[model samples]
Target: MGDEAGTANQGAPNAGVSKSVSVRELVNRLKLEVIVGEEALDRPIRRSKVHRPGLEFAGYYDFFPIEHVQVLGKKEITYLHKLTHQERDERIGNVVKYHPPCFVVTWNQDGLEYLTAHCRKEGIPLLRTPQTTTEFMMLADGYLMKQLAPEIQVHGVCVTVAGTGILLRGRSGIGKSETALALIRRGHRLVADDAVVLKKVNPQVLLGTHNGTTREFLALRSVGLMNVVRVYGRGAFQDETRIVLDIELVPWKENELYNDLQLEPQTSEYMGVRVPCIQIPLQPGRDVAALIEAAAHNWYLQTQGYSAADEFMRRLQQQ
Candidate 1:
């Protein structure tokens, strides 16, 4: 699942995982469980598994809180045995406190067979794999992560442009296209226009970009949709949107303290979900396009825990 209330990059931890799940689902992801040692079911797993797994294998932990881990291969046996008996006792204690992850692991077939025997011998279900440890962990992680990751409608956008999710929004007449055109002129590629699609992919990730139907170019008020590639060449266009700061367009209002938008940006409830929103009011003669681009890049700084508005407000309070 995901953390219910956090930015897209922060990745909320709860999407759909409840207090419990069906064994069938768990087995589908974890594949097999190998239970070793007679005391395996009695307490936590005594040995610590490898310190770090391969990147490809990190997805297998369905956020189970890592209650216990089994180190079965002979390579790790000496290191595991090096632990004091009391340390072993504490490690295994996590098993008693948490079930399911209590006892399971094997090195070679000998270890596997031993573990399998206890699981079957004691009526505990065990899973076996012909693949090596590396392959096994990958399969396990892939399955578990899929089971735990949130479901979102993705618009396929490159999100490496700073951290904030930047959304450009405005009415058809409001120069959303002209602003985007000018932004691209200023070097920020267009995300999506005409029809911008969005989706929440991971726990904290909200992906927005141009849909396949409209990825090629943007339509402007002064002109029709121009081919960015034709003008700026390649790398000037994209097919996705990462919605961090929402750049809004409306005729200028002198009464409105436009930039008072938000410094320590907070979530705005959209539909039933909450998302970070920044409102940028647009007006004529203000170079709306350049401002939107600047707003996006500035949002990056703010999201990095640097709040210009907050610091200014604090100083004003002191004065």
Candidate 2:
């Protein structure tokens, strides 16, 4: 399972903190074989970057980042093969002394006995992958970025309406899933229901997706569980999309005494990125689905520097 350390404490609506993943999780997710030091699987890989260790293995340890996962490719392994047994032992011993999170041998490890022995003795994890150097590095780096990325899980439904990712938040039994199902029937795509995992892959971009068995499924009140793909077809489900809008639904209240005119803009901050938020009060015959669709469309226009409300206000002021 993915790390839920960041999922437990979801602070005020949209605030989120950074996340971390253990070496054991990476090993299982990436399908890397544990060649030695299985006991050190609990090591925490603090850094997202993977080191090639070409220079380190070549007897140059200056500026080597031992906290990162080290990958040994064909070139690095070939270099070790060219060295005498004693030289190779000394070189590997030096690297093992640094105690990197783990060493991943890509493609094969036909001549890594010295390195493996030193790693096992020092209680350092040694992993191997059948993928080529480039392939393994690419996969590992991509997976690491996702696992190490700052994430926040929200109690909401994320759906794509008119190409805009909108997170619908509300209290329990507030029709969040119902609204999402309506949008999906209208040809929009559902990213997640019940629990939406938002990851800050980029500094300003937040991507929405679902974790575990919740993906591609929605739970309705009358209906127990329904698969979005089966009910609305395959086009109704999306793996992930950039979250751009946050819509909070509230039960209509009498004498709410709030601003009738939305003169002030509201935003929700998640993992340091701000997203535009709109609160819609739920009432009988409000056509919530259409309202959400319109909100998303308006937000999309706003991103392009166009605002209908602002334009209308400007014309009224001139009058």
In order, what lDDT does every prediction score? Answer: 0.47, 0.83
lDDT by residue (108-194, candidate 2, tens digit) is 667677877898899998999998999988888888877777777778899999889888887889999999988988999999999
Model 1 spans with C-alpha error above 4 angstroms: 1-164, 254-266, 270-273, 313-319
Candidate 2 segments exceeding 4 Å error: 1-25, 33-46, 58-63, 78-86, 107-110, 130-132, 211-217, 222-225, 233-235, 251-265, 281-283, 298-319
- Give candidate 2's TM-score: 0.73
* Tens digit of per-residue lDDT, candidate 1, span 246-314: 444556678867454445545643223556554456654676655555666776676689877778889
